[model samples]
Target: MLRELKILLLLIIVVGIIYWGVEPLAHSIMHPKVAPADYEFKDLDKIDLSKGDAQKGKKLVTENCTACHGIKAEKINPPMDNASSASSYGVVPPDLSNIAAVLDHNFLANFIKNPVKATELSHKFGDSNPYPMPGYDWMSDDEISDIVAYLASIASKNLSDKDVFTQACDRCHSIRYDKMVALTPDADLERYLGTKAPDLSMMIRSRGPKELSVFINNPQKMIPNTPMPRVGLTQQAEKQVISYLEKVGDSKKAQRDSLGIKIMIFFAVMALLAYAWKRKIWSDLH
Candidate 1:
């Protein structure tokens, strides 16, 4: 019994040293500055949204946005087909019908004013390769506020996890595990974003949820000058998107954990039996 206790103590010390000390120190060295997720988007708080008039916004949106984006719920279609739009704009623009539901309000306003700056992709979308959306800084804040109101009023509610991920991420990244391809082809995305977006099928497993959330909220801070944009998803939508990624990447996690518990039980029983047999043989020898 004393010998068994000593061996157990040795095993515990080895595991504690590796798990509690070495692993954390290694992770800290590897990821020296992992920034926290910024769901609030505090920088874009200047606009006063209370002054918005949805009726006026409707007219403004019809005059401005319809030429490029389609609003399926409102029965508005883009003037050009996907191929034609891709040819003209370098990538097909996403529909505007659900934009308000997923995107943060403050971030949305800033994105409209200056997409390059808002997305933090000015490093790539500079003068050499112009960004597709022309800045709307000339529009009055009141007009922009009205547009935001109209968008919020029209947005669909209670979007599913898959729907949230589709709206927030599927436009740029592909999930090959789910058989979902990116909306924009790799060649066009390469030209538009400075590189093709990475396939996100295994990102959840690789990066884990905490890292994914922080990186998604602010890609620029995670990797300086990353071509990937700060998507500006609302907190709820961000959670939904990450949930869907976990569903796709770790679908069998529950089953795997259950099996692991069973395996541990089997090992414990075998260890007890082995110890009992050794004690029986040693009793006769002593």
Candidate 2:
């Protein structure tokens, strides 16, 4: 019995070693190193603004940008209705009309391309504005240069239509005009129009004024699956929102009229089919 007990104790020690050590080693081997690329610092000392194309930069802004930056380069375009209110992230979006006057072109370009690196350098070196600006690394070096050039063109007086929107609506929402405008494929335009958090882009493109009115009156009734709560609106306010959406949609590649017509046809066909089926079933029952 004593000999058997000694053998069991040895087995337990070996099992414990395998469980703690060998298991971890196996896991590490299974998940081989998957690290990010090594950081390479660019030398901004040789950048020449004379060679940059501001026109090309403007085109890039119109195509890949303008969602957050606004067409007029007025910092937060489509300014929030209220400037003093807290945002969803508890921070307010700042204005950018005078950014060129404040920051160097190279500094702006580098910061835009790699926000994390810019922040680290700022913290290590002495730079103003410690806020972490989000990166736009997807843009090529030439594109970044053009963006910087176009940004330099923004005057304090040349605010866009978004600025007008901000001045009107910033009272309640955390209106970060720049951030919202910068979002691509025009994602925020529908939310802005609906006054509720629904991807109304598809609906806006597919449905017309009449259909939108029905949904707006009682969105949950029309779309039970939708998370949008019906915010009671005056007829005038609803029209304004619709008009805004129509204009904004036209400016972008998204077309609402086409979508609205398709939705109408689909529902009409379904209704006719349902009526015929019901009539046939009733006759058979009789």
Cα-based lDDT for every prediction? 0.87, 0.49
Off by over 4 Å in 2: 1-48, 70-76, 79-86, 121-133, 156-286
User: Each prediction's TM-score against the native?
Assistant: 0.91, 0.32
Summarize candidate 1's per-residue lDDT along 1-286 as a digit string, tens digits.
7988999999999999999999999988987666578888876656888888989999999999998999987999888886677667877788888899999887898888889888888788878887898888999999999999999889899789998888788768899999998887778777767787899988889988888888889988778988888889988898898899889998887799999999999999999999899999999999
Please list the residue runs of candidate 1 whose C-alpha ends up more than 4 Å from where it truly belongs after superposition: none
Prediction 1 global C-alpha lDDT: 0.87
Instruction: State the TM-score for model 1.
Output: 0.91
Q: Which candidate leads the pack in TM-score?
A: 1
RMSD of each: 2.0, 24.6
TM-score of 2: 0.32
